[model samples]
Target chain A: MTITITAFERSPDGGQGLARDTRVRWALEEVGQPYEVRLVSFTAMKEPAHLALHPFGQIPTFEEGDLALFETGAIVFHIAQRHAGLLPDDANARARAITWMFAALSTVEPPILELGSARFLESDKSWSAQRMPLVKDRVRDRLTQLSARLGDADWLDGPFSAGDLMMVSVLLRLKASGLLDEYPNLSAYVARGEARPAYKRAFEAQLAVNKPPAG
Target chain B: MTITITAFERSPDGGQGLARDTRVRWALEEVGQPYEVRLVSFTAMKEPAHLALHPFGQIPTFEEGDLALFETGAIVFHIAQRHAGLLPDDANARARAITWMFAALSTVEPPILELGSARFLESDKSWSAQRMPLVKDRVRDRLTQLSARLGDADWLDGPFSAGDLMMVSVLLRLKASGLLDEYPNLSAYVARGEARPAYKRAFEAQLAVNKPPAG
Candidate 1:
């Protein structure tokens, strides 16, 4: 059966890889997996049909035969497991890569998301100005630790695997916030991820969909 | 070789699983892994020895033979991959579980952490009261979707797996906030996780370590 994924008919970021689906699409593209995308509007996302596949009713649900999956981490992991390119060959290295994957989502991503939510969703609130700094500081705290550990490395762990992919994706959320610029190495790290032909393809694809209706 | 983990000698939570060590302990217990805990005073955590193992200068770093790992998600995942119980045998089911782990950390946990940050770190600020409701609403929105999906279900996915462990851990963060009570199913769902024997062992073990600082 053909692998199929649902993506926003138009992403809020206007095709920026910040959209969750872009991560899955990029992962598939990296693995050279030919697939189809089912575009979904924001309204359709909340409808029962989309909700059936994704309980939270979000974009980027993966379906292959009887298998249906949500959560970009899981989808990327599935692709990595099924196709060899995204994972390392050695068992220890593979385990380490997987560890980085979890680290990306669990440890690093939390503060970044907070920074974004505070800036975007709460910007209109009375506390936005005060809250933004606290949130950004938390993000910086995580990044300081992560950057120290990553210290002069091309990727988070040894070599780029799904770990780096997910980390870069999470970090991209802060692109507009200018906080990422505080860490020169982290900025270059994201550039490296975006430079990948696979990521470029994914970026362009998502961009094509959201290129309309300028907001 | 026996695995060793670092934890707070006197936890701020007074042994409540709010401490990161609790998650690591729960994962170790779930995997039937024999491990020893090394208690670190707050000062020691900032020192080089602890910082070398965990860049964040936090507790619950794992060291076994040559391998040193931090981040609860990474540690729990390492435990699950090495052991049999926490992951599924089926390829797709395993992917779904892993997805929940990511969702727990990335999607659900961020807002709760924001709540924590708002309540503790920023509580003294001039805008604390004004900022809280905005943060609470975000947490509630995430809970609403998650609770709706998890309605009438025992776990986040099929049976119980590491996914549930992570999801429960994420939900536990909001227990004291009373915001969790806004979603009855999620509150009950957290209660169900707390009732597990393994969870009991994990919670009590951490609680014992930080028991009132000898008061």
Candidate 2:
């Protein structure tokens, strides 16, 4: 069955590879899967058809034959489960890897997301400036723990599994903010993920779509 | 191997069952697995010993034999994968079920968590009153989309699986806020989940631990 996934017609990030479709694309690339992309405009995403694929009406819904799935974490996990390169052979290690994936989305990403809202959504509010430090500090709290656990390790666990993939993608959002620089190991960790061949391919693929027309 | 999980020594919710451990316990109950609970104080949770099991220093963490894991989504998922009851037999259904689990933790819960922070952490801020509506609206937006997709269905997908288990748990946080009541079907959906024998057992067990001591 041909695997099909959705991407934003024009990403809000303007091809910075922070949009979640890039995460799914990176997973497919890591697994050596040749999948098709169906780009959805902002308006089309909220339409009935897209909503059926994703109740949240967001981009990056995965479809393979009769199976339709949404949520980047699930899409990446599905790709990892179906292919070998993304998970470990050992049962215990695989479970641990899956744990980190949840940690990334549930524990780590939420504060970072708050930071995003502070910067973009609430920037014009009267309290935005006052609230910015609190938001960033919450993010730093998680990163502090994460950086301590990570210490000098390359990937989160052993090899670069789906956990690392998800974590790196989540951390990439903090790159432009310079918050990641505070934890040198985490900054290098994200760099290691970017250095992967599969990630490079995935980044280029999405960039091609979202890049502006040259003069 | 005996399955052991961790919980808060004294839950902040005072045994209302909003803690993530209840989600893990509920999953274990659904699958007919008896597990032991290890209560950890807030200080211990951030210490080295407990942090070894959970990098994020939050509960509940799962341990069985040599395998140990954290992140409630992953813990519930691990239980679901090992046991039969919480997941569907069909491959596609299982994938969709997993998708709901991710949706619960990633998409749905973040805004709810934001509401939590706004209520508890920033309640003293100058903008707390002004910001309350914005925070609630963000949560309402996600619930509106979820309610529309759910319509009259008892669950998000076909049968009650881990997806419903998780979505219900996430929505349970909104009960006090009255946001859930705005969507009757969603309110009813969470009610159905709470009404489950497994959920009831899980709730009662936690209540026993965190319930106030009798005079």
Clashing pairs in 2: none
lDDT tens per residue, model 1, B63-173: 888888877887888888889889999987888898888788777887888788879888899888876877788888888889888989999888888999999998898
Q: For every model shown, what is its TM-score relative to the native structure?
A: 0.94, 0.99
Weakest ten-residue segment in model 2 chain A by summed lDDT? A59-68
List chain B TM-scores, each candidate.
0.96, 0.99
* Model 1 interface Cα RMSD in Å: 1.7
Instruction: Give every prediction's interface RMSD.
Output: 1.7, 0.5
DockQ of 1: 0.68
Q: What class would a CAPRI assessor give candidate 1's docking? A: medium
DockQ for all models, in order? 0.68, 0.92
For candidate 1, the lDDT comes to 0.85
lDDT of 1 by residue, A1-215 (tens): 79999998878887666899889989999999988999999999999889889877887899999999888888998899899789999876787787778778877887877777766777788767756766777888888888887889998667789989998998999888898899999999999999999999999888888887658
Residues B100-152, candidate 2: write the lDDT tens digits.
99999999999999999999999999999999999999999999999998999
